[model samples]
Target: MYSKNVPSGFPRGFLWGGATAANQVEGAWNIAGKGISTAEVVKRSTNRKDFTMNQITKQSLTAAINDSSTTTYPKRRGVDFYHHYKEDIKLFAEMGFKAYRLSIAWTRIFPNGDEAEPNEQGLLFYDHAFETCCKYGIEPVVTISHYEMPLGLTLKNNGWAARETINEYTKFTKVLFERYRGIVKYWLTFNEINAAVWGFNGTGALDDDLPNDQKMQLRYQALHHQFIASALAVLQCHKLDPEAKIGCMLARMQTYAKTPAPLDVRAAQLQDQLNLFFTDVQVRGEYPNYMNRYFYDNGIELKFAADDEEILAKGKVDYLSFSYYMSTVTADDNNITKATGNFALGEANPYLTSSEWGWQIDPVGLRIALNELWDRYQIPLFIVENGLGAVDELTPDRKIHDDYRIDYLRKHIIQMKEAIQDGVELIGYTTWGPIDLISASTSEMAKRYGFIYVDQDDEGRGSLTRIRKDSFYWFKKVIASNGREV
Candidate 1:
């Protein structure tokens, strides 16, 4: 049966825009009073097996230094948004951007990671950047800590493990709340809280590998700390400016059962349980019953003090925001079933096509994901990341004919509008990337997902110029007509 159609247009004052992270887009890795982040220390490929927990010994850093002559900065000079904020903001303004979502680099503010005083230069950079967005009348949505934190903090204090991270994160939040009080009102406490459970495992939190048991324990512990930290940040926001809206962000990928069998149903249910376990604590201030049981069964006891629950309860989020790129399909299995090709992990939907990197393209799955989240949480959701990643060819006229991207967005926006019509209180929709920038999962530049094409490549060689793709014009019309134009 066909679902009901949306009305001709979106709600009044709907937000239509794009999202970027500081580490992915901000290229001044060490400039403007910034210290070395974990990203800077990364020399080998992240997709490799060792990427999860390979520690940066002195030997690795020294080897990096010795190889500096031969090694070009992998993340350095990433589209140069630090130096081109005016031009980029101008591009976003051209799209009638209702909001431009970006993150503040924590290291930029706390250079050594423990300094009580924030560097004036780091804070000033965002001050100017926010002013630029304001100049273009684009609302700025700021993420407190994206995937990249100061490497020094992780090496010494152990990222998100020690209680000290909560304090450090709180200080960072306090600085932003005090400084950008009225200029920016929308704040996400952490980039992808669910990722902590996954173990910087994919595109966020701590990107280290460990034994299966330790991985689960560390992930849960990190999440516990972040939940408390987010709650505290929310409380702090209310204290500083009661009108500010604070939300917890998660990397929410929808999962489906591969078939109608009971095991598939159970697999899909477990997937949902895994994703919502993070939100349940943040929104409801208590872990779900099944999740508690699972931890007990796995002997994964999370470390928490008496007051942590109180903090979470007091600081329940105002809204829920998430990034949706693709959906995965799963079937239950106790062992790796290499022969059947269906026993474990995601088997991308055969019915759907995939991106260059093999992420399935299912726009309707986006609607399914949205409705599922809304049904469970009941909080207003912001679709913070949904777009196509493709390989682009810069034409002779410096234009990218990216109709595939437009079609991808067009279908997703259609699903979003349908969800909104079906009583989903969606706050906004910002595609994965507004302009081309670095990829978070693969740390590659070729994974382009932008309405604005950035002139750069994986090797980091280009003019750093910006050109509007066809989707840029398409999105402008969609925003102008309140999505009815699509």
Candidate 2:
């Protein structure tokens, strides 16, 4: 348990940073030898409407591919970060960022995932990007594949479901490792690798039209391929630059039993086990014993090469990083009310409040998640993404008063300090998005999560101006004081 009277601050040299994905932030999707990615095919909703997983069905995706209109696909014009990266990095520096978490759009490096040669233009863009980060003394934490893969891979190879895609991913990772070897030291093999299992839409590797059993089989197979690719990437990174710290990213979803009944407790435990399956493979380098019965019951048989287990055993991650937006509850009874979070659904906790998007707010859950992860993995943990996404209004005086956002962050930071005091080896905390960008689930700008506000809207109409909200200064002071002032 965590106590507030410990009278301590964050560890020395703790990384204070922000995170963003290329597909959500960097526009210029078709330029500089960049091929169309799966993200490019996701249509942006016109109204501020929430999207269900059915929105990206196979038929709709095919239509989006043939549409040839970038207007419908807002990810094609993601905040224009490709052209405005220097400006944006400058803003991050102004906020006194010690690190920046971003992704390398795989399509940008390899116009097609299985290409023989790399794109010089795309490589040079990241070269300049990393150099700029180094210029400001901000360490770059790069995710090799952050829900952005070349569309060609899915169409031709069925994404990671096909074993060949692993080779292609290895090629991509090698290019990144060799190119940014010395400049970037922190690497995340896959963003939310577990999303491939439950939230297949985010992985962009699943076709919604597939049969239920087939979908499950393909999803698990694809997850297996990613595990192998991640492991191989870890080995390659060490060989190229032994100092590089490569970690696996999981969408950590903490759950609680609705009642003290043994059935409810067992249900919640099973749900948590399913959620932790990805981390178990990546961090432990082997499948858990429980998975044997799971595979038998589901009739899911994963294909493996002769050396797959050996490869996995040798390529375990150096650390564990994850995103925690909310916690949930479960029960054997169906009467419990449900709530939504970052592509996850569970019973609502009556005691906790929710955000505009109906995501339950639980600052103490963050501390609980930290302790749980540390106790399980016994490795250094990184809070790579945690924030509150709400509607922000720019006042008449051109200032945004986001005291609510500040309060949300302050409470979470307090819990984070307590988690550290409780003996969790925490590396750092980077808020989901330091500047507003496209929402991953809804593709709307209105669902903003940033201390620095980007002037944009659902229809993609704004001056593309960047403004610092009240929380921005508050965060700056917190970082300056090393989490003492928060």
Candidate 3:
């Protein structure tokens, strides 16, 4: 079956590309028509015992976490993509990128988060950026809102907690759709919409470290708001230009188990319900039975406004896009592998090595995820983010030997090709952090994910130089051969 399923190559017009988010890549943190974002308040700490580093970490371990509320310091230049986009896009074009996936900063458009009018300066910045990509025959795929929301709106209205957030989000999307309708044909309403289940902090939820009843409330409320907003944005795109295609981007987290035990099986099922269920509603226009039952049993009823259901039905997305990184093993009581002293939550994989940041490497899991997403939605799938995050060292001669990243991408591409041959209607493959950006989860400079490396560090000091790694040339060959050469 595996041999018969291998594809000779991708379809002729299949898009080959890479992706990045505005907040992570486009530093200028508060410059050039950009407004303050929650990321602005978010800070990263190296020493776990530093009390001054509040928003990014709360523990006494020497690691970083996003504790944004108390971290008063601003984010340092996050790769400075805002000013260096021309040079970066040129490199992408040189690599033969057919499509480039990026997001528009909402704060840049509506500085204070929401306004009756958008800042022309903000719109003009993208106008040039997208037009530049078009000039080189690279189609720009835009995510209207990434992880960073306007700090003004989030802090004032509690972000997606209030219904007003839907209105605010609509305001931003309405203008973007109308303005960039022709130049940017592909659109994602939100980046990782289901990530709210993790929470408001960097983990995309309120408390990833510990769970509480109130966290569930916050999660549900935030999801409800985003669902409504996404539905409305889809409708807006269609109304503004019926030819436009809008998608809801999600984090397609692949969950597995240390062993095929009953509890491990149940744990995996629960995660599918928790993660994929959110996208199910947006793509299928209805919630799955397991998700509905869980919500009811947990006493977490989702409230929708009067026109919410109608809006959702009318504005159903044209496709589904997701980011697949690592796979996780789970078990009910963390007792699945007692003899090996391994726990359900996490343990070193005996069969596979991990990224420096600890995400499990499983290229085959990508193919499995592709099939699951396609089987469930029956809609086209666009891979919005997929890549290897590693520590890249720039030699004195300015050369980066990133064969590890090349290997990571090569294996993933092989699985993606296999998935396509299996009849999954995949649109494009965009490796996350195409040009190294700050890590969203760890908030570190060293955790890199890019074919083109950015010279920077965690302490916010570096030459801000860009150098193509070995993966850059390998990826170029992949794009040129359409998966046959690489």
Candidate 4:
């Protein structure tokens, strides 16, 4: 879309690729010694607007676990990436991907999360996957724990709400670091760790009827335990693989003021601060002063271990990675047109267009997010996830023409280039799941967000074939030109 007159700002070796979580892409959830994950039992909603909560309760989870078929549980039958890794990675190589951001299924490594010995078959699976990625010259960027946690952990102590899961998680990370020491250098401790604020963090919190104050208390407490665990994992990664880099991931929610009113501006500022509170803790090695007042006013009390502060201070993340898809504006008014997208609520931004799912499209918001984060942290940033989820169609000739997806990404990449010129040290951009995988929130194949289209229905019926959309070649060109062609 840009002419040669606009100089490209993307850095050399700027890891260009795609991202996918284990739970969202990898099927075979209960095979080869892989245990059930918290993400496994939750069912998808028929309504596009409704989403799946982290429903890891005792009764519902038990019933869902007993059923072996993946017909209703669409996530259990992903795009079948587990069986198609070699093919998928080969396709990525064809597109000249420099990196592939993916996650390890915790259940596959530690069947019950507290197991002493690791699962060899599960370990072997990833070994082959990583070796294949390396063979194709793709750097493997792995998230130690994505949205899925071993359901066994949740059943035992309600997942991260208790202190025990932290140790189990660290043990899992130690296994990964020792096994894939030289192969995987870029690591993320958690996927969207800040999602814990809403209790839909996928950390295995029991999702059921609960009082508002109690739920918030439990969510904050669970998030604290995760902070401790992440710090511990950071320390372990450094100790084991001295050359490795460990980071914290957040689902960034960029906010804007709906009007120039002073209260509205302040509301936007406070919301953005609260959204970035996770980065302040992980990147700055301590909680911000603002959250103290938040916790006090909300009647939320956090219990910390004796050595928690020391661990956090000693093991700060080397980088900060985040997923930025959409942004919303906020106002101080009690009632207005509410914005709903990517699990955030605010005033609808009339200045931006909306995606098919009503996510307000604000390419400039990405530039704003990058500048704000870089100015605050001053460390390298990685955009691990960004894409549009839409209903794709396959033509009679077996071709998918998705120009809308191309336009969405093209605008965002341009904004990223602008941010780089503005002095944001960007590590790379990995659009979420280059191949179409089941949606994590809604678990629908119809909500496709990929350059490669998978022939799978929301009901888990199709050839499971992978076809490249027009955007696939467009992205290939963008990568080849290092964002100059876009």
Instruction: Highest TM-score: give the candidate number.
Output: 4
> How high is the CA lDDT of each candidate model?
0.77, 0.87, 0.76, 0.88
Question: What CA RMSD would candidate 4 show?
Answer: 3.0
Regions of candidate 2 where Cα sits further than 4 Å from its true position: 1-7, 46-55, 199-203
Per-candidate TM-score against the hidden true structure = 0.91, 0.96, 0.89, 0.97
Q: Model 1: per-residue lDDT, tens digit, 295-359?
A: 98888988879888788789999999988877777778644321111011466577887766666
**Of the candidates numbered 1 and 2, which has the greater lDDT value?**
2
| lDDT, candidate 4, at 298 | 92
* Runs of candidate 3 exceeding 4 Å displacement: 1-7, 47-76, 201-211, 336-349
Lowest lDDT 10-residue stretch of candidate 2? 46-55
Candidate 4 residue-pair clash tally: 1
Estimate, for each residue in 216-288, the C-alpha lDDT of model 3 and write its tens digit.
8777878877888888888888888788789998777677765688877887789767878778779887656
Better of 1 and 2 by TM-score: 2
Q: Which run of 10 residues does model 4 get worst, by summed lDDT?
A: 49-58
Q: Which prediction has more favorable lDDT, 1 or 3?
A: 1
